[model samples]
Target chain A: MLTINDLARPGLEPVNLEISAGEIVAIMGPSGAGKSLLLRAISDLDPNTGMVMLGGRAREAMPAPTWRKEVGYLPAEPGWWAETVGEHFQNWPSQQDSLATLGMPGDCGDWPISRLSTGERQRLGLVRLLEGVPQVLLLDEPTSGLDADTVESTERLIRDYIGTQRCCLWVTHDDAQAGRMATRCLRIEAGRLAEPTS
Target chain B: MSYITLDYADLAIAASLVLISGGASLVLRLDIERRLLIATLRMVVQLVLVGLVLKALFANVSPLWTGLAVVVMLAVAGREILARQSRPLAGFWAYGLGVSTMAVASTLVTVFALTTQVAPDPWYHPQYALPLFGMVLGNTMTGISLGLDTLVTSLTRERAAVEAKLTLGATIHEAMRPNARQALRTGLMPTVNAMAATGVVALPGMMTGQILSGVEPVEAVKYQILVMFLIAGGTGLGAILAVLAATWRLSDPRHRLRLDRLAASRD
Candidate 1:
């Protein structure tokens, strides 16, 4: 289970959230509803006035590297920093597993990330972090770029992966995507969590 | 060497020119106007005062005074570089110490060990040591700034990526590898560019000064080569030292980038 309390933003109330083990908790909200901010807080990308506990221990208590490794975050847009695909994997083996799981052939290791189509980059980013095998996965708009067909493929892939892993918190804007991807759905208005009636 | 006198008229003109330009700059950039104005005022006053002091220092002919003067200049330049370049004054002393060591060791190696001996003449001679030391310190200051700027920018931007890597069991160096490489290349660029343009487009300051003072063009050219060598050496020493300095102070024992000490202003 992943538990986040008071995550993101000051002066606003502390956000409380939980995604049970082996369940997909889909988060839906309007623009700037702290959706992506949630992913960052879990990964310790930006400091938030709150606590993130993955598994049992408080994430803040352990070093951030340990927390991030245990809980992977895939931002909406992938490949923000590294220029090439090979560059992304700095002599690490998890890279090989991620590339393979994303239906990429072995030689994809040599491919430059810029050459990858949008779907490929997004898929690789998710799979790459998963190769690290974090117990909790934080995915933000994992399929925003692809067409309907690719979206289905990504959703199925994530569902299958979560069945094997502990949990995944998926963020999306589309109602249909949330229903398709999430076992339980939620919405945030302004900055407060609304009941996931849908 | 033929001596050129600095007349009172030269001093007065330089002062007036500095005041007009310097005062206008102060009025225009007011938010951090104090920094610019004080730095400009300090530069003008310090250069002229140092020039006069050097003249007296040379006349007095004391190695102790000359050595002490260089040490003072190195300390001041090191402090300014560490302070002016980046934030987190907490790490300033560590950085200052590292840069100062390179500046002194490199200057001594160039003046005493490398130069052809005119022993007594070389000791307090503003002609030989001051200019060489100035070049090394100036480049070291710039190098450290560029290096620090690159590292800090990368640290903030790639904080997530770095954390990701570290969790993957990469050690601190492995985690910081990409950022470190980026900063190292950016820091090394100025010296590389100077090397590329050394002879063709640019007439370097020291060589130009020598040629203006009636030294033969070929003779000036020889000194230019030596000076260029010294500059490259200084760059290597400063860049290596800066990376080492930043590595220790930039992170906590937990190996996390500490933003508490980093200045709010990106520049």
Candidate 2:
């Protein structure tokens, strides 16, 4: 289980929550309501006064890199460092399946980042994040810029990934998408998180 | 081997060069006549003030006066660095870091040169120490500002990508490695170009000054070479320190990028 205790950051009210193994929690809020900031705080990317524990291991107990590896976050606009897409993932066995499921060609790995469209980059970024095998996924508007077909495929891919004893906290502004993906829903307004509703 | 001395009349003749340039601009309708004149006047006034201060300083060389002058120069240089930065640190750290780096690096390099290379009579000889300090400190200040500015700019521009990397299990150092390298390169470019263009393209200011002051060409070249090396050392040290210090300040103990600490640069 992932447990957050009274997490509070600037421009964000204190929040307490929990997600058991294999749970998918969708967070919805108005723009600038600290949705993204809350995800950042839970991932320990921003300064926050609270305790976050995954499976009873405190986020602060381990080294930051180690903690981040287990609790992966896919930002809205992903960062690609290397010239080629293949450079991001290193010898992961699931690469073929991930690419194929996302409707990306096998040759997509060798393609230059400059050639990839925003949608392609977004899908590829998900593939890159999943190859790391994170225990908890903190997704920030994962399907914002993608087309309808790609969005459905991406949602399917996320659902499949979280099916195997992992968890996720997805931030989205769309009410329909939230209802479709979330096992439980939480809303944020004016910096406060409301109680979860099934 | 004495060189010609320029009196007030000769100085007036040399001032004609500015009028020539300004007149050309005016005749061509380039619209820079006023700016050109103002810039020329500022340069002349500033140089004259510096010359007067140096004359008094060289007349009575004492540690107290020398130190005071160095401190004042550092303050001015620190402000210049702060002003040039688009994304300065939120508070005094913006100026403090640059000043401290320049001060530490320039002082060390200058003292080392004095003790080992120049070896003037009293060691704190204003003539040698002050000029060397000025050269080293000035270069170091520029290098540090460039380094700091580049790092901050990159951090702000690539915030998403950097955060993505951080969330992917990369340490703060790992995430910022590329930016740090680029910042170092940017900082070192000016000194590297100076080194490359020194003898062939143009005579450096120090060598030209020495030659005009009746020093042998070979002797002047030797001094110029020494100054260049000292400057390179000071600049490199200041640049590296500035980047490292910036990296440290912009992150937290938990290895998170503290973007709040940065003030958006007013470019």
Candidate 3:
């Protein structure tokens, strides 16, 4: 679970929200609406004037790696760290399920990274994040390159992962993905964050 | 060879180019003025000094001066490599050792063990030793600098991916192996490519210089080949050492990445 306050960027006013464990909060906005900015702010990759509280302690007061281990952040484009996919899962315990949930075949892990499609790498990247088992997951355009089938499967994987482990803040523009994955939804309009309930 | 006498006309010609370029640079707009002036001034000052000192050393013909010059050149090259990395003094040890060892080992073997004669006066001639050593050391220094900067910057940029691995129990090496390999490959590519394309595609500057100095083409080719190998050996050693040197602190005893130990970038 995480609480955010005064999380604003240049030429933008502060906005706030809270997310709970096992909850999927989909953030939707038009292009340039700072949807990805919200996730990056939580991840400590981008500095801003605000506080991010994971569990109860303020992220500002916690060590970055400690907070980061508790909160896994994946960029839209995942960076491949090695030459093979099996190498990606060799240390991961949730490897089989994460891969299967993302609609990846068991032997998909054996392919050389250079031979992989972007969508495949993205799916593997999601598995890598899940392997960390952080208390909070921040994803930005995570399934951008995935096919409709893979996207559906990836959304399912994300939902399943949140059901099993932690809070999730997913950023996407697709109305279908929002409906399928989000327990609650927030839309960023004119650079401000809001929950539909509020 | 004996002392090289200065022809005032040749001096005038070199000086004229520098001055004309420097003066032309003064009237130029922002971006290139300082660079032109600096490049011109550096060339003029460096060549003039090297010429004067080399002439004296050749006339006096002392082994001590020659060796001292070689040491000074190595120190300069070493300092340049460290400056580019710009980390604290603590981080430069392995780089210093790496560059020095590569430079000394390659030069000694090339000059003393193989060449048999540099100047007919003395086989261990300083004029040849100092300049050749400087050239090899400088290039390898650049190789280490490029490799180190790329590795450190990319490692920090991809910290999240690395941390994901670490939390999955990937050791520092395993986490960084990807970035480390990329940087190493990029660093070594220039040296490897140059060696591969030598002679037909491009004539190396050392070989060209030897030819201009009236050395036989066959002899020049042999020396060029030797120098290329020396560069490969030194650069390979320096690049690998620079990576291991900077990343020694990637992990703490707790087995987590000690991100804060990257004092250069953390600031």
Q: Give me the candidate number with maximum DockQ.
A: 2
- CAPRI category for model 1: incorrect
* iRMS, model 2 (angstroms): 0.9
TM-score of 3: 0.57
**Per-residue lDDT of model 2, residues A91-162, tens digit only:** 744599888888889877778888998888788888898888999999989988888888899999999899
TM-score for chain B in model 3: 0.76
Best candidate (score: lDDT): 2
lDDT of 2 by residue, B73-101 (tens): 88999999898788889888988988898
For model 3 chain B, the run of ten residues with the poorest summed lDDT = B86-95
Clash count list over all predictions: 3, 2, 0
Q: What would the per-residue lDDT of candidate 1 be over residues B1-267, giving only the tens digit for each residue?
A: 574877888887876775676578677864554675688779878888987988988787677887888888777776676665545334455455445655754575457523564233555576567767778777766776677778877777777677556545355677787888888788788988998997788888888888879898899888788777777777676766676667666665555555556656645
DockQ of 3: 0.10
Two-chain complex of model 1, DockQ on C-alpha atoms against the true structure: 0.17
Candidate 1 local lDDT, residue B42: 91
lDDT by residue (tens digit), candidate 3, B1-267: 223556889788877776676667576643576787778779879988988988988777677887787767767776676667644324545355545554654465446523653444466566666666666676677777777767767777787677656544455577778788888887788898888888879898988877877788899899888777767776787677666666665554334555555545425
Backbone clash pairs for candidate 2 read B86-B265, B87-B265
Whole-model lDDT, model 3: 0.71
